[model samples]
Every structure is written in structure tokens, then in C-alpha cells.
Target chain A: MSLNVVSLVSVGRHPQSGRARRADQDGRAVELGLKLVAKALSVVHVGDPDDPVLRQYAGMGLPSMTILKQDKSIDAVPILSQFLQQEKIDIVLTGVRAESGESSGMVPYLLAHALGWPVVARVADIVSVKDGEAQVLLALPRGQRRAVSVKLPFIASVDHAAEIARQSAFALGLRASIESVESVGEVDRIRVDWQESVAKSRPKRLKTVKAKTAAERFKAATAKPEGGTGKVMKNETPKEKARAIFDLLLEEKVIR
Target chain B: MSNVSSLGISSLGIVRRDPRKEWIARNRLHPLYHEVINEGLGSVVGPSGLIRKNPHQIGFIGPNGIKRIDRLKGNGADTSNKRHGSAQEVVLPLHVVTTPDFYLVVVPDLVGGRLSSHDKDILGLAHALQGGMEGNGAVVAVCFGDVKETQFDLAGVDRLIHLTGTEFEGFTPEARVAALVQIDTQLAPQHWLFPDSIHGGTDLGSRLAASLGERPATQAWQVIPEKVVCRGAGGSLDIARQTPRIVMVLEECGNAIDETRHEVLPISVDALEIQSAHLIDHGQVAVDPNEIPLAEAEFIVSAGNGIHNWAQYHQTAQALGATEGASRVAVDDGFMPRFRQVGASGTWVTARVYLAVGISGAIQHMQGIGQCEKIIAINTDAGCDMVKRSHLSVIDDSDVILSELMQLAQEYGVNDKPSQENSPEESQNVA
Candidate 1:
């Protein structure tokens, strides 16, 4: 049986400029979803339908993208959950984590919980889908892949290590339409109350010191000394180099 | 000092001195500290007061001389102001009871018995609690698995709720999540913290969050009083929950705790029933203990993008009796196995000497070897980050240096005649 795969795409934000764009991982997810179900794939987003970044997905030749019109006050999980519930969706594909806005990396997990479906994270590739089970290659640390089989009607978050997303076509971008749907669920009061500000690089932490007396502890804790410049070696022969490396190793006790 | 009642049970255990030696071995028997030299790093001082001298650095000066104790030996340092002329009868606190508002659940690495470098859930939890709550309300830790009371670095925790059983053994996801759920229901903590690491943490946190009807923030970096801040696309985003119940999976917190305060709390063991699930197959994937012995390897020779011949690098590692490690790119290119990959996502090796070959140091790769005592880089790029990070960097071809190093090893009898001839294909790593 052909699967009904829903590509859950989100507008990614640029790191330095905070400009809305197609998240690299999410684009890869869209690419993967297209590869898996092809004509049956439906693109879904839970943000502004008129947002310019939504066109990036459409430019990838998606015929139509569904935008569940959720205001910033509404939680994406409940909105996406309600939207997905109305369809016979077999799989939900999203990026491992969103690049901007709440970036909890929990949307897929939350969706799994809300829909009572198993969720797999860091998915590198979908090996095969057969007999109500999907065999997948999970991306582990260090570029390793683990083969795991999960029963379908599941959610998968594509790993950054997956294939690069294809470039958006200009002609397709002109033709594709954003079908806006009514927002679902009540506004999440807590999310709406959250104060938003341009994020700055975090401040340096206070140095913790262990000392005998309170006075000495305070002195040591606040002492911010300049670190010494490291030594750079040059023009040494192979044997001499070997000896130097060996001595340093021995001093550091790398080898007995 | 008049404040005797404020100390915890672990504090009392310290007062019971070893009569044989006046100076206490500062470092406890946590598996991590077993191999490290305990002279400067251990608790060699007389039972004097421990102070948070510096971040991740603790110092106690006595007749034995000033010594820096391992920060991770015990729970957070005791704040009790006690001075001793010698090993006089030390006052020990019996029990510490407090109503815990925050719960830090430390799921044991059933495979390793004790938590490894990768699992810093407890540390992050403590930091978050101290940062947000200012250590006010109780920071209760619920440890699940065959973990002993002493195994955990319980520096900031107020109460330890240990759940251990034969059924709770191994990386049993269902049993572990069930146990945490039970604790959540019983304790009803305002904030719940889990390690946002790959090792079953994501699964547990997600399941627990779902079960409790609270959205969990995975890989959260900061925990303020009102919200948990995590890195999103543009910058950092704060995850604020309307209700009191917040499930958080922690990523790396910037600072490491000092060992000045070793407050060992009383342990309350609850044996939970085995909770079974058919979703994920149990006993399927088992990480071999010896597969990637990168942590314990004294010497490591790591290959990077520059090394085209991995077989030669592997042979060089065998010649020097060093563990073979690779950068992410090398592993990605299929030159080396993922187990041999070294970096943040890979093994955090505390090897005494790390020999880098042809690898430009990426920040992620540099994090893995940050703990290495000495780093020697051999890269053609003179200005690569690895060169700056290394103690000795040779701006030369790695192939020449490796052969020379192997020759030197053979001359020093480090590589036996038979061993020198053995190829990488004949012998495989124990991992």
C-alpha cells in the first residue's frame, strides 16, 4: 500500500541575521519525504501562510503547501496534532530540531505523544517501508548509522547528516499556492507571555574557587589571569621530532 | 563550628577516618578517578574544610601541602565551617530532610554501571537548580539502575531516591521510563530534568513528557526560574511553560561543579516492577565495552581528512600500542568505523597523549580531545586550529612523521619484530 507521508516544514531562521529561510535539515526532510512518497507527499506548516519563506518550499516544486494559520500565541504541537488527526497520515517527517522559535527539538516527540505514534530521531535514511513497518537507518554520533524497525504511523526527524536539499526552481516558485487553513486550539497563554528579545552571546560565568578561607576563596575566584601563548615548533628532523613527541608523551604519561 | 546538624550522612561517613593514615585520600572510588594519579588530584589533606576555590578547581591546604581534589568525587562541597588542627573527632551530620520542589532524575548507564563523561544530566540538573532556585528548595535525584549511593557525583542534590533492581538492569527503556513516571507521580516535582544525551535520554524524556501531558524541551541549554532556554535556528529561545510542571532534557551547561562541598545524602531505595513494551525491541543493540576503549586508552593516534591511507594509520597505532581514533570526516568517508571516531559526538578521550595526523581541528573534533593531557598535531596546514590547540605541531606531511615514529618505536623495542609485521587486517581493535 502507498503511504501518505506529510512533510512538516518550518521556516528556518538564519543564525547571525535571524532572517527567515528554509532550514537546511527541514529542506532535507522535504527532499526525503518527496523521495519516499513522491506524488502523495503533502507539505504542511504551522505559521503564516503569506510568510515569504514558505515560498522556498513551494519553489522546490511542491504543488500546494497547507498552512495551519497559527498565531505566535498558539502552540504548534496541538495545532499540528489537530491538523494531522483529520487525515489518514501514515508518517510525519520534520527536521531534527527547528532553527528558530522555541527550537525545543521536541515537536516530533510531542507530535508522537499527541498522536499515539512512535517517533524516531536523527533519521539518516528510510531503508524500506513494508508490512506496516519502516526500516530506517538512524544517525548516531560519529557518522554511524544504526538499523532499526519501527511500526508505522510514526514520526521521524531527519538528521542534518542526511542528503542535501535540492535547489528551489524559479518557475515552480511562481506557480505554487499556499492553502491557508483556520488555526486550531486555544492560544497558549504561557507562550504568548514569553518576552522576546534579540539573543546575545551568553555572558562569561563567574569562576568557582575552592579555598580555605572566604577571603582567599573570593580572591582566587575573581582572579582572571591571561593565558600563556603556546609554543610552536619548527625545522626539526624526523628523529629529533620523534624524540620531542616521545618526551612530551612520557611527561604526560601517555605511555608507560 | 557549631553547625553539626546541617551536614548530610555522607559527611558523617568521612569523619570515620582510616586510622592507618592521617591524610585522607581526597578522591573517592568513582570509576573515573581510579586510573588518575591521586597525589595532586586526590584528597591528601587532613580533614580540613573544602572550599570552592575555583570553578572546577577545589583546594585544601594542610601540613601535607596544598592539594586540589577531584571536583567530581562526591556531591557538592559542604558549606559547613569546620576547622581541624589535626584528625580530631570530626562532627558529622546524620540526616538531611527537605521538601523537594525540583527533581533531577539520573538514569543509570546500565551498561557502564556508573555515569560516563557523556552523561552529565546530574551536573546540568544541579547547575540549573542552583542557578534558578539558588539551591533553595530541595533538589531530589532519582537514580534508576544498579547504581550505588557513592557512584553518583551528587554535589548539588539534597535528597537521593535510588531505584535499583535486577529487572531495572541494562538499558531497559520501558522499565526506566516507568520508574521515572512513578517517581514523577509520587513526587510531583515542579521541574523535571533528564540528560539530553543520545543514550536513552531522549526516549525517556519524551515518553515522560507525553505521559505527564507536558511538552518537554529536549537539548535544553539553560534553566532560568521561569523558562528553559535552548539554542534554536536564529539564536536562543526560551521555553516557558504555563503550568509548574516542566520536563527538560539538558545539554552541556558551561561550568563544572567544584568538590569543595561533599554532601552525601541518605539513600531511599525503591524496587520498581518491570515495565515491558513491544514498541522497541529490547536486548537488540548492545555497545561493546571494549569496542571503543578511547576513554581508557593512554595514547591515541587519530587520523583526519589528510590521511588517505587509514590502513597505514591503523598499523601505526598498532606499532605504538595506541588506540586508533578518527575525525568525523574520516568516519564519514568510510575510512574508519564510527566507533573509532573522536569528537564531541564521538568518544571524549582523556588520553594522556593524543597524536593527530593530517587533521585540521574542527571545534567539534577539538572538544573530544580537550581532556587529553598532551596533543601533538602533524598537519600540512601550519595555521590549522589543531596546531594552535596542540602542544607540539609539526607542519609536515603526516605519512613521513608516522613512519619515523614507527621506526623510532621499533628501535626502542616498543614494537616487537612479530608485531611490526602484523597488518591492520590481521588484528582488529577490541572495541
Candidate 2:
């Protein structure tokens, strides 16, 4: 049986320039969805229907996009969960976290809880789907991966380690039709209490010396700082220099 | 008599002291005083039959080749001796909470069966929160799987709930969350803190928060009893909100507890009836070094324009068991793929050890490798920026170093064959 896949996209802010653009992981989610069921993949957005950034996502070869028209202050969970329940989607894909707003990364879990469906986090790839179960790979730190098999009708959050989204074509994006659905959204009351401000850079933790004795305090104050100048091997033999590099590699445990 | 023994005279046998040598040792102006005295100017028997100590000669040479004096005298001798591995155990005062009015729960990621630095930071934040409130508050750490963390006391865990079973092993988030849910009902903690990390911490925390119906604060850096400051909008804006019951904290949220030890009292949770999980874990997949992405790779060997033999560079990376990386010039020249490029414009690598061969480091390239712990440069020019940034630099021809390194690696691989065989077999078993 053909699987019904839906990818959720969001407006992303560029980390450096703070410009509104296509979100990174959300685009990857769409790419993964396209890879799964290319022809049947449906892209959905929950914000403004007139957003120009929505076209960038559509430019990923989507013929059209469905936008659930809602205001920015609305709680997306209730609205999204309601919309998803009606679609009867076999698989719902989303970014691990949104790049804008709260960026709390709780939408998938909250949606899963509301729908009573299992949600997989940080999925690197969906290896296969067979016998109503999909084998997925989860990304771990240090280039590690965990393989898992989850039943269909589940939610998955795409990781950055997944295949990158294809480039957007301006002409294709302009031709794609945008279907807007009007929906009344409940205003989020809790967010009103939050005070938003420009982020202040955190201070780098300094190495504080906890000396019990006067001599140690003196040593800590007067001792020359470490690791400024590196050892340069100029006239050493090739064997000696190679041995030095090898020893350093071994010390770092990178050559194991 | 003790002074005479310290002066190199045998205590068992009575020996006659030469008057000339004794006079030379006693006389500070005497040129032969240092040579005649076996012990340096520490302490000596004065002419008045009292022990005289030269306060200036109380210390030994420090590691930086400078003379340092210890003011604590003989009391500080063990501090220096501790470096020789016969450490005098310095026991910190224990912090015990007999009656906890409230509980601050911490669920650590504990990567590799040990409390990671991120875990410790959250634990510290839990303690800071505990300190801010009234009455006795205990920081309870809920850990899963095989816990190899022996220093939980040092990490400021007042109470430990270690759950170890086949169900809690591997990627069993469902079973782990079930256990946490049971703890929540039993303890009814005032606050729940988790490390906002990619290593299952955020996943489990969000899952628990969703099930508990608590709107958790994510990426929280500054947290207190009254308020929490968290980063939002991809770290561009900070949102200060009233502290929530569930908080996912960022690294360095608080300083790690170093001064005092905790009880680490073992706690138990009542039996949890875990529902049938929809996800089944098949364990980890073996990824080849070359297949791993440059950003997540722990060790990277990158090439640049100075590399004459492209084949030799690839072979060197293979031998070193490192992910292949290339400079912008190498990618621009079509020697490497675009994804293999390492720079500000390309993939920023967090490799523990970055080996740059023949790359004169550009400003953007240096910025990319800022987080790398150790950088080794093999360049012809000694004055290059890469060489300057490197912790260990070899000013030589790249061709010579690459060939030498390859041979050494081959020999090392042969010697390390026995240990390396286990990894392949383990991967095969997983498959």
C-alpha cells in the first residue's frame, strides 16, 4: 500500500544575518519526505499564507503547498494536531526544532502526545518501509548512528545529518500554487508573560585556581601561562618528526 | 642529633666531624660552604647549639624551571607528593539532606555510561536552584542503563536513582521515560532539569514534559528560582520567563560543584508498567571514517594546494583512520568534492585533532577550526598562519611527512591488529 507522507515547513531566521529564509532541518524533512513518496508528498505550513519564504520551500519541486492561515501569537500545537488528525497521514515529518520563535523543539512530542502516536527524534534516514514497519537510522554524536524500526502512522523529526535539501528554482517556485485554509487560532496566554530581548553573549568560564595555601596562590599568580607557543621541528630527521606527530596522535587517541 | 643525621652523618655510628668542613658549612661567606655541605642551605646546627633555618631555601624547582618556596613548610610536602601517584586523599565535606522539603530532579544523558560535562553542568544548575529555595532541597539524579559514573558524589548528586535492565539499555527511550514518569508521581519534584543536548536528553525531557503537560523552558542558560533566561529564535533573542517546572538547560548554565561532596544515596522507584513500545532498536551501525561527515568527525586530515599527489593524500588519510577534508583551494582546483571542503564557507569541523597538510591557513579556515583541540601542520613555510596556529608543527616538505606517516601507520596497524579485530566482529554481530 502507498504511504501518505506530510512534511511541515517553517520560516527560518538566518543565524548570522537574522534574515527570514527557509529553515534548514524543515527543508531536510521535506527532502526526506520527497525521497520516501516523491509524487504523494504534501507540504504544509501553519503561519501566514503570503510569506515569500514559503515559495522557497515550494521551489523544492512541490507542485503546490497547503497553508493553514493563522496568526503568529496562536499556539500551533492545537491547530496543527487538529489539521493532522483530519489528513489521516501515515507518516508526519518535521524538523527537530524550529529556527525561529521559541525554538523549544516540543511540537513533535506535543503533537505525538495529542495524537497518541509514537515520535522518533533526530532521524538520519528512513532505510526501508516493509510489513507496516519503517526501519530508520537515528543520528548520534561523534558520527555514530542507531538503527530503529518504528511502526507506520508515526511522527519523525529530521536531523541536520540527513540528506540536504535540493536548491530552489525561482521559476518553479513562482508557478507553484499556494492553497490557503482559514482557521481560527487560540491566542497563547503563557507567552504574554515572557520578556524577550536581544541575547547577551555568555562569558567564557575562566580557570579559577582554588589554592588552600599562600605558596600555591603565589605560584598560580606568577607561573607563566601554558600553551601559547608550539614546538617547531625544523632540522629533525623525517623519522623523528614523523614519530613526534605519531605520538601526538596517539596521545589524542585519534589514531586508534 | 637529628640535625647531624640530616647533615649526612650516620645515626647508628659515631663519626668524627672534620673541623675544616664544619667550619666551611657554617660560614656563609666561605666559597666551599656549598660544596662541603651535603644538604643545601635548609637547616643546620648553629654555633650556639640551636637549629638555624635558611627561610630562602625552603622550596624546590617548579615545573616551569623556576624556584618556588612553600610557606607551609613541611605541612605542604604531601601536596607536592600527590603528583607522584601516591596521592593523599583529600576528602571534601559531605553535604547531607536529612529531610528534603522539595526535590530538584536531574536526568543526565550520561554518554558512554558516564556523566558527561553537560550532565555535570545541569547537576550544578539543579543544586543552584536547590540553594535558591527555602528549606532542605536534594538534587536527585535519575540515570539509566549501565552507569559507569563513579564520581556521582563529586558531581553533586544528593540522591541517585540508577535503573539498569535490558529494557533500559540501548535506545529504549520508552522504558526510560516510563521509569521517569513513575519517579514524577512518587517524588513530585519541585523542578525537573535536563541537559538540552542532542544525546537523548532533549528527546526524553520533551517526552516527559509532554506527558506531564508542563510547558518546559528549552535552551535555558540562566535559571533561578524566580526567573529563567533562555535563548530563542536560533540563539538571536533571549526570552526571560518565569521558571517552569521542567527546564532543559544549556551547557555552562552553572559552575560545576567542586568544593563539597554529596551523599549519593541510592533511591528506588516503585514498579513501572511500561506500555508496549512502537520502536524496536537494532543497535548502532558501523560507519567508515571516509563515509562520516567532516563536521561530526573526531579526527580529520585535510589537504591543500601544496599537495602534489592526490592519491597519496587519500591513502594517508586512510592509514591514519581520519575523515578526509580539503581546503578551499583544493576544492576549487577540483581535487576534492565540495562537501569535503573545510572552512568558514564550507563545513565547520569540530574534530578533536585536525591535521592540515601544506595548507597555509586563511582567516576563515582558522575560524572553522577554532573549536578543534589540537592542530598539527605539515608545511614548507615555517612562517605560515597554519604553522603558527598549530600546537605541533613540522616545517618540512609535505611529501616526505606524508610518506613517513603512512609507513609508521602501517607498522602501528600491524601491532594493533589484535585490538582492532574486536571492532569488526562487533559490527558484524550488530548487522
Candidate 3:
């Protein structure tokens, strides 16, 4: 059997601001990492330092999952490369990029190039691993799929549509000891210099139109030749019975 | 033969190229890259001397965007001073990285309308990396240097790792993978980077990651020094090393550098050589039983749960072409493809004409029908997302709709005639 390492699963933890962190790690970014570990020989995990509630995820041992104490100084990319290489692991799974680090979705491309492996993007399935080759499924835009074949020792980015992402039984959410490793390679560092968003002297709220339910949408859908009853305007001429509405200001004297 | 197969690849054969393939070759191919691939093949070198990509080390994938097709396409025109207005013009945004020598670019030749986009991305990134790494350090890319897009202030970083082979064209994912792997082995750059899109670069990053053991993360929204967060499902998140491990960033995601003062740098080559060049292997797909040919599918019933009622389904199925299917409610209660579903997340369909009854419009479902060019939907609510987006929508009840429509099908032999010829633009609406 091929050397499978890592316990990849979609994981969830409520954002620090959201009152409560999420309980499930399914159907989310961490799930991509979880999926990468779906078939693991042994796995290690690292977590944010302040979050202790995240500990219960790695207890069950059938397919081991581990967690590391997250230090602000260490990034996940290099440590992960070290883990995979040291284990002689053959495949790695992850999302295109994390939901949080959305703007920097370049880790996989970098890691693949660094590890000297092929990185499959939007990969839906790892069909098989026989004779050093791995057949995979790729999901394209508009949900189209194409079956691609590549030799192993590659990384595949999981698609959000791959599956609902299997959930872990609550009863199995036991705590496990997560090993800690000092991270290496600090590329560039900057001093802590921060600024907060300045509040306006007179903060104004944005006016919003809400779509509470489907019925309120008749105008958007049915008013045009396009099938919906809602009116959909076409190209307009400047002077054909033009109408305008004006707002009157009360004498209090100001609108910016 | 499918015209797409002409290039031995599956992209649309619609060639949008300006017949400048030769011009592309001259500027694109760097002597460094050409020399490496050629020399590797020339000398029967083996894996002994190659710099195998080490997962234990760092796998830094750099950003390689498309070459700007039109020089002024994205210019903000910040160069001219504004004689009026309190605001000053901002310098045009450049996405070069802080370190150049610490990265290597991996590129496949061009294809599609993205050649220019890819070229710009690669060059922009190269400029960013080289700009940052100027005085010292070097980033190694995994290309057999038929072309390289590097921008350096000094000449030291101007190098290419070209692979020699026509099979390494842009769309040849398999061959590209093999060559990238070889390059990683020979060049030893930990972090691999490439641009998102704009060039013909797709799947090259992910595919390359799979070939190596390193865990690869895709889709990053931003990359700050020491912190690399990846976005996934439920505001899903994945971080690259916690703080330290060298994070190889693509140009757009990481810190920006100065590219305006970029100057061409010339570098001496080590004459790296490739011992072998061949195809990369992609394994196989497990065939699901339901995925077999449906030509023999007798009375095939495909229900878009979007179809709200049993009544309109029967009518629309008959009117356009197709056998009626139970609504999701009816099916779940024991009538539909309890084993089958349609649209993006469900069973992919290849029917005569999928009777889209009351189905809502979704990008996922649309994907399964890229091959199916025709769709007809019906529902009592004219505003159903599916119907409005379909080729035709009959506003009526299923029972009345189906019974009357089946009569039309039986009379006009609707199912016997193909609806494939419906205007494609109008037709795309249904799926």
C-alpha cells in the first residue's frame, strides 16, 4: 500500500468575534486539510495558541490526527512541508486556500513546486493509487468535472462541492496530546505597527433593501420580457417621457 | 475527431492566437531555460546530481501572472501630476514580492487567450522576487526555460530552467507535471509560486503539489509576512507555518515591491541538464454503475427538485421532450431517482432533453450539463429560477400541463425529433 499520511478533514471553529466558535469542522476550509489527511499513516496538527476548545478534535486513533500549539511566528506552509517530507508521505490534500487567507491562495502552488510534486486544484476525489499513479477528479467552474490522471507524490486541493465533508461523532471528540515543534524559516519580519479604523464624526448607516423571502421578489423576476413578472428595463433614451423624483430637505440645513 | 484534440489537448479548438507563435518564442524562451533542458537531455544525467524538492525543507511556490497583453491595460496613469484637486495621484500598484532569489517560477507554455495574462503574471512575480532578493539569494523555478518572465534590477537573478520538449505546452497538464517534478529535483527551491490566472496556468500548481508529498494549499486571499491563511468552506481556514517557516508568496498576495525602476539583469548559466523528459502519469477514475451509457435508459426519468409539482412535470416532460419525473417531495415520499438527482450536486445527466421541472437555477447543476445542450422547464410559478433560465417555461399545473403535453408529444412525436438545434444562447439558459 502507498504511504498515506495526514488526517485531513474540514474543521470549524467560531471566529473570535462571533460570540461562539463553531463545533463542526465540516464543509469548511480546515476540511480541506482534514481531507488531505483522510488516509494517513500518522498526522500532527498545530492550532492557534489562544484556542483550547480546538483540542478535542484529535483524540480518536484509527486515523490519527494531531494538533500543534500555534505560535504567531510559525506559518503553516513550511512546517507542513517538513512534516510531509519527513514522513515520506505521498499525497497532500487542502482547499485552494483557506477561507481566512483568501487573498493569498498561493501556498499549494508554492508547496508543490517546493516539494517537487504536482498540485491538483479543485480536486474532488482521489480515485485510486496503484503502481505509483493516482487518478483524480477535478471540478471546473459551473460545476463541470473532468477526470485527470497523475502520478503520486502530488497535492490535490479539495473542492467545497466534493461532499458535505464527513462529520466526526461528538462522542469521539476526545482530547489527544499534540506534539510541539519549533518552526524554522522566518522569511521577512516587520514590527507591530497598527491602526484602527477611524470613526466618522457623524457616522451614518447604509440604507439597505432586504429580500426577507421569495414573494417580495416578484418585481425582480417577473416584470420583464425576460420571463419574470418584475420589470427589467432595457436601453433608455434620454427624453421619452422622462420622470424624476426629488427629495425635499427640512429647513435644518444640511446633507452631504 | 474532435477539433479540440488537434492540439492533443481538450481545450476548445477556437484558436484566438494572433499567429505570433514565433514572436512569442523569441521573447518567451530564455537562454538559461533552453540550456538546462537541452543539456540535461544531452548529457545522460540521472537523479544522482539533481536537487530533489525536499518537503523537509520548504516548498515555496512563487506567483507567476500573465504578461500584460496591452501595456496600458491596467495603468492608473499616476505618472502625471494633477495640477488641480486636493488628492495626489497614487503610484500604480505593483505586486512584486520582497524576495526574488528565494523563489523559482514553474511555467507551462501558453494556450487559450491567457498567454499574455500568464506572461505578465510570471514577469510581474519575477520582478517582485528579484527586486526583493537583489543583493543576495536566488529563487529557482521549475520550468525548462523555453520562456521565463523575470524582472530584476540587477543582472544576477536572470536565469531560466527551460525544459526541452513540445509536449510541455500549456494545456499538457500531464507532461507539465513531469517536467515540474524534474525541475524541483534539480533546482531545490522550497517555495513554488505561479500566478492565479490570466495566462494558461490552471491546475499546474495543484497538480504539481500532488506530485510531491508536501501538503499544498490553494486559494489564498492574502499573505502577510509570517501569516498565511487559506479560505475554505464555512469561512474555512488553513494556515501555512504558524509564523516562521519561509512562506513563498505569489505576487498579488504578499507584500508589494518596486517594479517601476526594474532593469534587465544578465546572469551566467550553470548549464543544468535534464537526463530524461517524458509524460507525467495521471491514474484512473472509479466508474460508478449509474454513470454507464444512458442510451439504453428506457423511460429515463430525471427530476429537478426545482420542479415543485407532480402536475406540471408530467405536462412539461411531454411538451418539450422527456418522461415525467416526480417532484423532490413526491420522490422522497417514494417516487424519484431516490438513487438519482440532477443538476450540479446530483447525478450528472445525459438524457434526450432533461425535463427541468420546477428546478431552481444553480451553478453546480449547470456543470453537469455542459455536455447536454438542451433543457426545457415548466412550473406553475413563472418566477421559478429554473424555468426563467431554461429554454422554455410553460406556466401551468403539472397535471394539466403533463396530460395535455403528453398528448402533444404523442401527436407531434416530440420525443422523436431532436431539440439540440434550439439557439445555443437561448438553450444555455435551461441548464
What tier of docking accuracy does candidate 2 attain? medium
Rank list by DockQ: 2, 1, 3
DockQ of each: 0.24, 0.54, 0.06
Best by TM-score: 2
> What value of lDDT does candidate 2 attain over all alpha carbons?
0.86
The weakest ten consecutive residues by lDDT in model 2 chain B span: B1-10
Candidate 2, residue B208: how far the Cα is off, in Å: 0.8
Better of 1 and 2 by TM-score: 2
**Per-residue lDDT of model 2, residues A1-256, tens digit only:** 9999999999999988889999999999999999999958999999999999999999989999999999999999998999999987999999998999999999999999999999999999999999889999999988878999999889999999899999988888988999999987899999989999999998898889998778678878999856664889999998899999999999888876
User: Could you give candidate 3's per-residue lDDT for residues B1-431 as a string of tens digits?
Assistant: 11111112125522232223323323335444334222212233347986454332221111122222212211224221122211344343332334444544535233322223334444444445444443533534334324534433321123445455556543356665666666666555635655454222446665565557544444433443334444333343443333222233333443222324332233233434433322243333322212323332212235554444544443344344333333344345544543344445555555534445445556665565535533455455666555555554455444444455445445544445443332222123222
C-alpha local distance difference test of each model: 0.66, 0.86, 0.43
Q: Which ten residues in a row have the lowest lDDT in candidate 3 chain A?
A: A241-250
Query: TM-score of candidate 2's chain B against its reference?
Result: 0.69
Model 3 segments beyond 4 Å from truth? A7-40, A59-64, A68-70, A101-103, A185-256, B1-431
- TM-score of chain B taken alone, every candidate: 0.47, 0.69, 0.34
User: Of the pair 2 and 3, which is ahead by TM-score?
Assistant: 2
Whichever of 1 and 2 has more DockQ, that candidate is 2
Residue-level error in angstroms, candidate 1, position A85: 2.4
lDDT (Cα, tens digit) per residue for candidate 2, span B1-431: 11221223345533334556555545667786556443554687899999999876655544344665544322222334224222347788999999899999999999878998989988888898899999899999999988888999999999999888888888898888889889999999999999999888899999999999999999999999999999998899899999999999999878888989999999998887888888999989866676787898999999998899877887777778888888999888877877788999999999999999989999989888988999999999999999888999998999999999999999898233333222232223221
